[model samples]
Target: MAFVSSERIIPISDGNGLEGGGAFLPITPTPNDVWNGWAHSGAWIIQNGFNGGGKDNVTSAPSQAAQNSVTVSDPVTQHTAADPVDVYTGAFLYDGPGLKVGNGEAPMALDYRPHYSTNWRLQNTAKIGYGWTHSYDIYATERHASDVDIHTASVAEIAPYWVTAQYLLDTVTKIPTAKEVALRVIAARWATRQVLKAKVTVALGERRIEFHRLSDGSYMSPSRFRVALEKSPEGVFTASFKHGNSIEFGGPNAHASKIVDQYGNECTFAYADDGLASVTDAYNRTLTFGYTLGALSSVTDSTGRSVTYSRGSTFDMVDADGGVLSFEMDTYGHQEILSVRDGLDRVVVVNLYDVFHRVWAQQPLGDALKPTYFGYAPGLAHETDAWENPSWTKFDSRGRRVQTVDMLGNVATWV
Candidate 1:
């Protein structure tokens, strides 16, 4: 008889000394001959033709990468669909050649790769004159645009500015849906940047009005100034001017009322069902307003001064004194260009806008010729010729003109 083992098989011969002796042959197991069994602990037992039976532990073990699919609480609830919780796959650590010791601890590598992602990268290296420096760049995966290192500080030195910038970009600027963009545009149009807990000084002509914005979004302008504004809970606003003259504005559906002077001379207002009707001034003079086909047709002031408006592709307003102000509108019907003309139809003032729809220049009837240039930084207005002398107006982060520097380097600062 011949016996077969896992490593080798031996053949037996009977009476091999004879010339034609018969020998026993060895047989090997096939795939169908293998046995599959299970252990008491529920582990699978696999038997191979060459190696015999063994337990398969590789498939039974849990995978570390598979833990990424585990459920977890979302940190950012706003814009839930675009949450970045599951965006990262894994993290890795690396060290540089430089080594240093600190606090009696083991020597550690001086440089390290803290964190990185497919959408983010860190550059930390030592420079000759600048010393060691690091920068983190964040890329937009959807747009495939260039990366922006938002960690840089602004002139105001506000900390963590990148957080707000990223939030705005994710929520507003980078929104991919058209419906979301439309809704955001509408909301922004109606939103008011009300001054809350701020002190502001406004220069009008030759006077300066200092005002303080209250915490409740209300403003207080003291009696020292010529103008003041007060708001009511019902959305009504009352504007008081010098000499006890005041104007009160009602809600959107209500008309405005006014008091001319200290003697309590009242001016009552009336409005038509669709629009404005007429205003009777303190002197019992009525200023009438007329509309034709939902458009303003004429406006007559209390002093009997009237202006007639005609609307076509452009809007033209001709005053009773023969002065004309023609307005050119953009595609959205916004007044883009204004041309002021005298009775003779000669241009008096022409204001122009750049391609970006910003106020580029203002041309007034002048003897020397060129128009006045205007510049802007964010929300601050920079006009070099607005002051008494050639000067530059500087505004703080709150968009308040905080300082003014003249040509002679004389600076007038406001708190």
Candidate 2:
């Protein structure tokens, strides 16, 4: 017989902050007992009758779908050519199909999985076929489980005539609400999903601008000062930057793009079958890159300056003039420490970081190390070097850093 260690046991909380939701004493599950006996047991003994869990030895559990159906108070209206219908964007629960687990020889137990469906109109115009239907698969068990693991799928269809409404909205001058801005942003993001390497023209009053998505998840615009979007794997825009006056994505290869500035200066990129080979800039200067065993080996800059890199325990790079730069990475692939050296390999600058990968201090070669301290509130940094100089930074409700107050009461405001 095997016994589980006391350290391996986890104490589960009851929903009402009281142990077992004021029903019984908290049940601490040992690893061995939880894994071998109650891993997939229909209703946990501790959670029974506390938060919708059925009584002991009950075959059928209560349907969460029938219990928790959310009704939206203010749903959006989807107007069609025939009639306008109300679209619900809130969760409407339903009983999902039973999931078969364990061996086929064993009796199949009913899995009480509750699913929800949310429907919303992506485009507010009178277009008939432009909307989104979102469905989610939610788990019923695990009291501490947040709503994050709810698997969601969004199905959207954009009609050809939908562009007319979008164009009109772009040309019209009106103060949009927070909801309108959020809806428009989601609509723009949805429009670019799965449409890789294709040009789409939109007429905005007298101007016709072409929008296209690259293979590497970037968008090109026909307008001046094109905005380049870097998207994540989920088709969400992570970062956006202004490119030159004109930008075009290369063919099958993602890296072979070109950008031309307002002054007719151009920069072209070339790539090998695997990676980038060289970049020729507007001034006819070339920067070449080299790879070794599928890893970046060297980078030769436009000014004929070269930096060669080697990877082992840490990444070490040496410039052509013998200056060295070494980096130490955390498990999450973030550079925790960066050390810069001179020609003689003497450390010139050292950057340090906290566990969350925030840069806390920087030490120069000849100066005394003055460490910087950061105070965080929720998601934004609220203060920096506050322990030493007593500075306080404040952010707005939108998480934007608004103002900073130093030790001398000097206030700096950001717009």
Candidate 3:
């Protein structure tokens, strides 16, 4: 077993044993400030909301030693889903002792919009508000689309603590779907809010289904606690959470209620399966679940050798039975890989889909709501800090408030 200590950024040492050659310097925090730059300062804001308006929040400054680089940390202090505030950007720079590095004398803008926060967060928020007019080709899965979907252009608004992300989803000529149409709204919000949370509502004509953050803080059961649309209008609507995965239904027939899991696990659900394969819309597909306890399990792999993990539940995927020769859950319990033998035109193929999950914050809808699991600056080391938020900042070297990047992708100047 090999274990190595992790540092935020590799410090550059000049011949004189001094950090040099950059506007931002990666420094190591010493004692007395153990949680200085390392402590989480706020929640993460997601960009996927109703109509594509996604945003996130960040409270602390980036590390000096890790400037222009990514430093995974925790959420801001006292953050939650219903806080009514949004976050768009954050940094991991060093600001010495006081909270503000330059006290608005300088401000660093974080950018580089990517598909998922996980992607850009890992790469560090180095690429800010990029790819608005960039053209790109995307590969589509058989289950998602028939061919590659081309993207034309996209744009976003860059803010000190907020960002507004926008993307022109379709490059090829085609009318957008309700989902696509809705993304526009989400995109708009994501562009502006610092931390953005949205309730995704699916409207199948008069029959509409909606999903939002587990706001109520009551998580007795994932299945039992959910908001329902008794009478959905032709347009879209957002719902509110009460507690424990429970929701308050709106409209005339609306009532405070909850939902039960697929397998009937009431509260304190446990994940119990890997995954299974089937057909959907007359095409081959797979359904992965968010592991909940005692949901369902199957044996596959000819000899039935496999590993499995635990999760809340699986998303629905419709496919044919024969195409799926076997199924087994990996040791992880949350994901299960399916082996489709000869189903791919005599080609042995395996397709895996990972299930995503969300945990609601334990706060009243009336409170400043936030998600427990996700927040702006969400990462392996990031945590939320609601007590003292990052109102603004300034970089050290240039003594300028605004940080400008050089052609070489370096922090060119702290203006």
Candidate 4:
């Protein structure tokens, strides 16, 4: 295999994309150092709550990824008079946690967002929230135009982290007299999109503030994780996260009014006809921002220490103490890539995103540098990582791993 070596982005600015860890630090740290959108590539995951892909009684199509279901009468009422049970046949095959009936729940119908996070890591960015992760992961949920609130439907996270999918169903239990069984059954959708109800979203990002409404009419949120999204009297949407921070959006033009934390900290930015604005934190320390249109010019901390940026055909950054960080770009075929250099002008980070391999085929400029492939493919049962080294895995038709081979050719077989 042709392995490629590369570097990771070590934020040259005191902002969001502070990913690659090294001996990097800003002149100072504060709130203004948090949400610099332009600090990294525009292609990164935004995690802005929901991604807008919901379906009513969705089914899979691809050969190995298909979730084949039969619409036979629900076993509970298949032979009786009460409205048919809502459950289907194949659902039982997937009822267990981390259990697989096929290759994966990855390539799912509800996972229609065409983003790399979803495709690569199988992460459902559509929500930053969830209810009873395990109990709800594979479950179907729905609501109708005339319904009072959105309720769980059935199909059936945190239980099975690697697998994620959610489907909407029009099936509303009649609660009529029917045969009692060990499992709950939810019928498939029989209506079209015109009348299909919208799905309620959960705001469950990893350790991020989580919010979910429970059946008893109470919210299952963190100690102070009350309202993730709420509607105002003016019909505007306001999202509040943990720590009393709030994001207000949807004004006259649908633009997001800058975020404000609990202590009343705000981003102080300047347009062109003005001097740099000062951003004061809850601690009273302030940072000054200067920009030169389309580029961030400099940032000065309250201590009067500054980090400056200069860009021409290439980019360069200098810290308060004269430490230098430089960035350059190159094109291979048609793809343009970025490279970062440290104070010594030594290459520390390289940008090489390979679309087809589904990963970055290069390792960083760390002490131990080597060509490596950190990516996965739907057809390939195994993957490699910058840490795990080169490994091979054999998967069945359903996408479940059957065998694995490490770079040393060590064999591991899974039945």
> Candidates' lDDT values, in order?
0.37, 0.36, 0.24, 0.34
Write one digit per residue (lDDT tens) for candidate 3, span 1-415: 0112432322222111233222111133333322222222222222335122233332334345325632223222211121211122221111000111111110111011112121122221111111100000011111111121123111111221123222543422277788876776676654433223223333221123433222231111123335442223532222333432222222222221222233332211112232212101111111222223433222122122322322223212112243322222234543322222233433222222212212112122212333221122111111232333222221332122232222222342221
RMSD of each: 34.9, 24.5, 25.2, 23.2
Model 1 alpha-carbon miss at residue 185, Å: 31
Runs in model 4 deviating more than 4 A are 1-227, 248-278, 331-337, 355-359, 366-369, 379-388, 391-415
Candidate 2 lDDT, 2-105, residue by residue in tens: 12242222223312132211111224544433322111111123333443333443133334432442333322222111011111111111222222222221
TM-score of each: 0.39, 0.40, 0.18, 0.38
| Candidate that scores best on lDDT | 1
In model 1, the worst 10-residue window by lDDT is 136-145
Q: After superposition, how far is residue 195 of candidate 4 from its true place, in Å?
A: 12
Cα deviation of 167, candidate 4, in Å? 19
Which segments of model 1 are wrong by more than 4 Å? 1-253, 258-262, 301-305, 363-371, 378-391, 407-410
What ranking of all candidate models by TM-score puts the best one first?
Answer: 2, 1, 4, 3
Scored against the true structure, residue 391 in model 4 reaches a CA lDDT of 49
**Which model, 3 or 4, shows the larger lDDT?**
4
Worst 10 residues of 3 by lDDT: 132-141
Cα error of candidate 4 at position 293, Å: 2.7
Q: Over the stretch 182-297, how does candidate 4's per-residue lDDT look in tens digits?
A: 11122113222212333223322112332333323233343333555554667454566656766555332232333466766543222234332443333445455565753446
